[model samples]
Target: MTQHPMPDGRRPANQGPRAAARNRAALVAAARAIYAEHGLDAPLSAIARRAGVGQGVLYRHFPDRAAVATAVLEENVRQIEQAAAAPDADLASVLGVLTWHLTESAAFIGFLHADGEYRRSGALARGLALAERVKGALRGHLPAGHRLATADDLMLAVSMVSGAASGLTRAERERRVLAAWRLLGVEVGPLRPFDG
Candidate 1:
């Protein structure tokens, strides 16, 4: 197999799969933060720089910026799903769980909007699937027959919460999210004023 050239004009060390995977994870995390701060338009070269690795390292891990975005989205989805799996919850409890996930998933939220050339929906579907799981969780908590009825509503609320997170300031974002939860009858924690 032909070895790819490193960005620094050197060859990569003969690292095995485990090391490569670790580096890829680091690069994905760095890319997520950069993308969140700078939006999708952030430069791949900058992502490489922030990762403390070379451009070639990023390219090796993510063939392009979209790939990095997708990986970030997938991570977000994984996290939300894991949170939704917290056992024993009512409708309010379920919404609170989702609220926490959305708060933590701010960076990956961008993937939910990538319907263009970036095409990161595969990664997004994982997160969307979590919403579906949350719907299921909510069903068990609600009164009989009310659980499934809220599926569409919950999904819509998740979408709105995600949208609110993007345009509003961090403080405004939290307020919007809290309001959304309260509207759904979820006993959300009090939100701090916007500091950022």
Candidate 2:
């Protein structure tokens, strides 16, 4: 079948540099939700449908699956960076943000170890930097005498939450997060969705 761009010779909402950027952002956002719900293995076409864009548009913005996933990971890193930079941010605050991310981006983290175009991208580097920011905030609002004495402690706490959260629902992930915090003696009220 012969396809046409449009009667006006330009497609709807997918023309120009501004639309390209918007389409790229939409694709990335759609990829995040699709990946979180369906795992990182979800088809690229799924992301296109979720973004309300055609496969051609998705491919134009992201040359491959790794490119789209890398964009999502980059978005995550930026969000964490913003959360960590808040003036009143503390250990609990940082941990809360990480907790929210654990459920949403666990597969994205695995991309750090995967060999692909994503490896060449700087997304993994930003993710590692976010770790340092998290480690730095561990002492800000921890319980007295129950503080994490070293970076390993932070790793242990994060691992517990992330490990337990694998393949679980949002509420289940929240429960696991709370248990992990208590295991480390850092009583954060409850794991809630992080807006930052």
Candidate 3:
């Protein structure tokens, strides 16, 4: 079978999968940066420009803004999952990591909350699923007889932290995050450092 020319007029190094993955990663990174800088309403063209890829590549990787948002949320959830899985991570460490993530992700989360269309997107569903996993991990770390009643409760706590801390200084945001954790009956130990 003859291979088709790639979108940018370059021949595939090893078929399309590798290039597609790289393009998708670049698109996601661009989307994250653009959204963080300009909120969810930022134009898709901006993401394409930032990724150094054409609009075709961006559309191929993410069909719409919600899809882009979903990719970012999925990545955030993956990082939180990794933190939860760390051998030495305890409840406090987990919360600390989550706090950092939620704070950093406040803008994206706000956009998700505000965009009605995103509420019904598959990405949102996946995000909620990953969030449940996070809640399960937190439950595993809770003291015996202490448990969050539902994943919704965990999400609410996250929302509270993000909403309450928006535009605040890092120290203030950390303070709000710790306070939110305390309200959830989680022990707020030393805040953990996060690379993101």
Q: All candidates' TM-scores? A: 0.66, 0.73, 0.72
Q: Which candidate is the best by TM-score?
A: 2
Worst 10 residues of 1 by lDDT: 187-196
Per-residue CA lDDT of candidate 3, range 1-196, in tens? 1236789998656647877888888887788778766768889999888988889888887888788888877776666677778888777777777777666655665654554767766556666686687777666676555555454565566667667655545566567766766776766545544444
Look at candidate 3 and tell me the lDDT of residue 57: 82
The TM-score of candidate 1 is: 0.66
| CA lDDT, every model vs. true structure | 0.61, 0.69, 0.69
lDDT of the structure predicted as candidate 1: 0.61
- How would you order the candidates by TM-score, starting with the best? 2, 3, 1
Superior candidate under lDDT, 1 versus 3: 3
Better model by TM-score: candidate 2 vs candidate 3? 2
Instruction: Supply every candidate's count of residue pairs whose N, Cα or C atoms clash at under 3 angstroms.
Output: 1, 0, 0
**Residue pairs in clash, model 1:** 171-194
The stretch of ten residues in a row with the least summed lDDT in candidate 2 is 187-196
Output the better candidate (1/2) by TM-score.
Answer: 2
**Tens digits of per-residue lDDT for model 2, 1-196:** 1135788897555357777787888888789889888877899999999998899988878888777876786676566566667787666676676677776665664765666566677657865775665555554555555556564776677666667675556566566657767776764532434465
